[model samples]
Target chain A: MNKNEIDNANKYLSKFARLTRNVLDEKELISLSQEKTLLDDYLQMEQLRFGFKYEINHSEDLDLENIEIPSMLLQPFVENAVKHGISKKATDGKINITFIKKANDLALTVTDNGNGFDTEKKNNGLGLLLSESRVALLNSIYKENRFTLAIQSATNGTKVSLTLSDWL
Target chain B: MRAILIDDEISNLENLRTLLEKHCPKVTIMATAQSVSAAVDAIEKYLPDLVFLDIQMGEQTGFDVLKLLPRRNFEVIFVTAYDQYGIQAVKFAALDYLLKPIDIEELINAVNKAEYKLATQIQTSQLDFLLQQLKKTDTHVSTIAIQMQSETRYVTLSEIIRCEADNTYTYFFLANSEKILVSKSLKEYADLLRPNGFLRTHQSHLVNPKYVKSWLKEDGGILLLTSGEKIPVSKPNKETVKQALQRQ
Candidate 1:
């Protein structure tokens, strides 16, 4: 193979290895700080590839540093924010990942400035199905049924939010 | 036979030229282009008999190359990386293509097929068919283009009720009770129209699941459609028919 081809192959392999590490780390509980760091790094990698911007919102009084929770719980939704929203967008694609302290639960949202599609469609894609199943599984693990995932899509943009009670 | 080679990759273009020179001696290399603009220039200047095309070319695609063309008197043999949707659309359109990295046998076969097609001129309106297929690959069943003797007919999938196969020809039974005979085989339409509520209940019949009103279990299962047409469901196809109804 040529030098260019070899370099390209190595670049792809390193990227694949990093993602494989994430999948392997899915077995453990990831803290809020770890989750933020992981997703932020992921957003950076995607920015290098697709030239999209990522934003995060949090407050100082949240006390969200070391609380352990499910691993890779928010990856699917965040992935959708890029695939559906950012990729389809022609210019200035931006994604916002927010963690708001709700009254009884912690609400996490992944919002994208992308042209949205119909959420009611049966065969939208497997990403939504996988995310729904992951939420259902996470809900069963908790003591109460305090987990919810909502998807709202329109021409303006798309916002997907998940609420986890007692998650704080 | 003269041909134009279009690919963004210099290596792939060189490889194809070498392969063509070695295997297909009849096809003379007229020109080589690296992008859609260069391809258009070559196509206009040479007006080659066949054009070997790559689907992806930097910011432009093989479809974009076709879009800028002034004429399509030449045949095309698409060469693309393995793309599920793109390949499916090409198959539905019944166009010739060679997959990458190019295989010697597939390359020769594609070139020979294109040569035969160009010589015989069996089907005249391929570019229109290709454009329709590209448009259809993005959405659910909206409209289908059927080739007529001297022209093309576009009909919404909802208007068609059933399709009957008679040897090589297909008879489309529309909602208006008019039967249009198309020269294409039924199997081609079966794959294209299957997702759009069309079911192959019998070897000779393809019926729309929405038009089916009832099915009688006696005498090897006969479906009574809303049009009062009795379509036989073979024993082997009973499970298929049941599953199709359950999906509805």
Candidate 2:
């Protein structure tokens, strides 16, 4: 293998190790910055694996280091997009993640350009199911700011958005 | 020892090759296949002593390849990335599996285990158990392979009443009043058993809802089991435990 490829591989290994460590951590909550770092590591590793087949973009409008949310709240949704959406597409797949401050709510969304699932049908995907329960668990823990999830899909693409009401 | 690598993804196969070359020098890679048909062909031709099999291919799985080769003359180690069902089946058989972005130490350990099993010519019943598990659609009827210090025990889910965490180890409390100590954390088993009606009522206690006799609301909540054991339920999980019990 080329030295560049080896370097990329090493980076992938270290990032993956950190991701595993973060996931296995027993902590219930983490900062927005820490969560972003987790997603950054995860997406970077995926980029190494998939290379130029897909593109990912990120945008945020919040104090990442100060605001805190439930740990691993967004990972499953991104994983769902990668596994069910872009991975199956032939080429030129795109994923966009946005974190926005809307009034008293925090809005996080992940959109992907791939074959989307039927919005009317109940998704039985394991990642989706796990995240659904996780949201419920979080709602139980922090009953103040109710967390709501909305998913929209069509044949061309899919978008998943989560709104933490009165969180900001 | 000779080995064959089978993965639909070229990069993963490459990664495995690099790790094997760097860490496991005792084994020789005879062939690599990317699809089920190719894997079957390579295995038939090479007749490898060991195989590193990927769980998911295009439309088929590695189990399909295993099914085609009925004769059990080779050792197998499964490699996959976040395949819950596949990993569950493999774990239930006490088989070795490496998750991708594969850890070098885990890869080395799996290789060493495969090498030793091949050398000893030990007939593994794990494959048969795994195949049986895959055949069964209902997980409730399936048996769980519990790895102990000296031997692996296969027991059904209903047989286990609860699990208690002791630091890095977990103790399995069975309905037969027998206890088995496993070297894995409570969190791991909690993940595996969550879908099967097990409740994580506390950080240190995982209870099977089937064995719950009654819920005691006093003393910060406790579950009375059919086995006459009182399992403590934590404050946060009390609501969940109550809901789960109500659903039963």
Candidate 3:
């Protein structure tokens, strides 16, 4: 095999292994600082494969560094946006992430400027379905309907927002 | 022994050739094919004694080639990455196969097994049995029926605490101090119960994960079950047993 082909194969294997590890590494919750660190690492990995700009915006009111949230909570939405939203578009795209501490809840919004999909359709794929189910499970585990996911899409772009009610 | 290598990837074919050359000197490399049609042509032309075949070859499957073969005259060693539902069938029939990212030891072992089986009379009915088992396992059923002398018995997989091998018969220990014996090998039940959270703790025992209360890690290992029964874990199976316990 040529050097380029071998390199590509090795790269794909490493990427696959990393993603599989991430998926299988399950826990109930993680500290907000640790979650941010993981998201940073994941963003670095995704940037290598998808040509899109990733931005992080957080509110100044809350101390997120010491907080804890459900495991694998926010990563899947970013992954879905990159895979279904930006990757399919013709030209360059941007993913805007916002972490807002509301009065009664902490909300995360992932907005992508690419081809918007039908929010009602289940077939946009497993990422959304899995994320929704995971959030529901987290809520059930917490013994309250505290976690909620909202997905909204327009013709120009799509937005997915997740809120943890009375989030700590 | 003449062998033909069939895989869609050239690199895998070359690697297998090297492995066979170094590990199995008794076998001669006859030819190689990279696709289903090519594999069929090579098999017909060379009439090899053994065929090291890959399961997936792009659009065509290795089964297609196996079906087109004039007769089941040669031994086949399947090489594949993913097992899915096919491996249960393969193991059920006692056929030889090597998982990819192949190990030299497994390669030698599978070749030796193929040789031993080829020397004896091959049963074509095993394939049919495997297909039947595959059909049954395709559904997401949690219960398995065991046949006794007069009538067939049924038990949910979760109801059984463990299975113990008594020669060809298997004894199922249930939660309510009930014991039932069935006329089937432990290997068959092991293959069936494996995907259902039952870990084969020893050659004679397969313990359910939910029923395992504790592991006494001395004398190989012993699992303390919820039913107050302790099952002995084999030496090599100790680490796996520990990992599974930790996961639980």
Two-chain DockQ for model 3: 0.01
Q: lDDT of all predictions, in order shown?
A: 0.76, 0.80, 0.72
Report the alpha-carbon TM-score of model 3 versus the true structure.
0.41
Clashing pairs in 2: none
- Give residue A48's lDDT in candidate 1 (0 to 100): 59
- Give candidate 1 regions above 4 Å deviation: A1-168, B103-105, B121-123, B132-138, B145-189, B202-205, B226-229, B235-240, B246-248
Per-residue CA lDDT of candidate 1, range B1-248, in tens? 89999999999898888778878999999999998889999999999999999988887788778878868888889988644436655655556777676657668888987887767765556566667667654565466667565545667778889998775678999999989998766755775687677887765688988899998887768999999999988544566688788878
**What DockQ do the predictions score, one after another?**
0.01, 0.05, 0.01
Q: Which residues of candidate 2, in runs, are more than 4 Å off?
A: A1-8, A11-70, A73-168, B9-11, B44-47, B81-85, B113-123, B138-141
- Give the per-residue Cα lDDT of candidate 1 at B70: 67
TM-scores, one per candidate: 0.50, 0.63, 0.41
Q: Each prediction's interface RMSD?
A: 23.8, 9.6, 19.4
**lDDT per residue as tens, model 3, B1-248:** 89999999999999889779978997899999998889899999989889998987888767678767666578788888655436645654545677676656678888986676667644344444434455573555455556454444556777888888776678888877899987666766776677677897866788889898888876646889888888887543566677887988
Model 3 chain B weakest 10-residue run by lDDT: B122-131
Per-residue lDDT for B1-248 in model 2, tens only? 89999999999899889878877999799999999999999999999999999998878999999988877589899988764647778876778888777867677888887777777666656777788888887765457888665556888998899998776688999998999999877766776787788998876789999999999888768999999999987654677788899999
Whole-structure CA lDDT of model 1: 0.76
Q: What is the two-chain DockQ of model 1?
A: 0.01
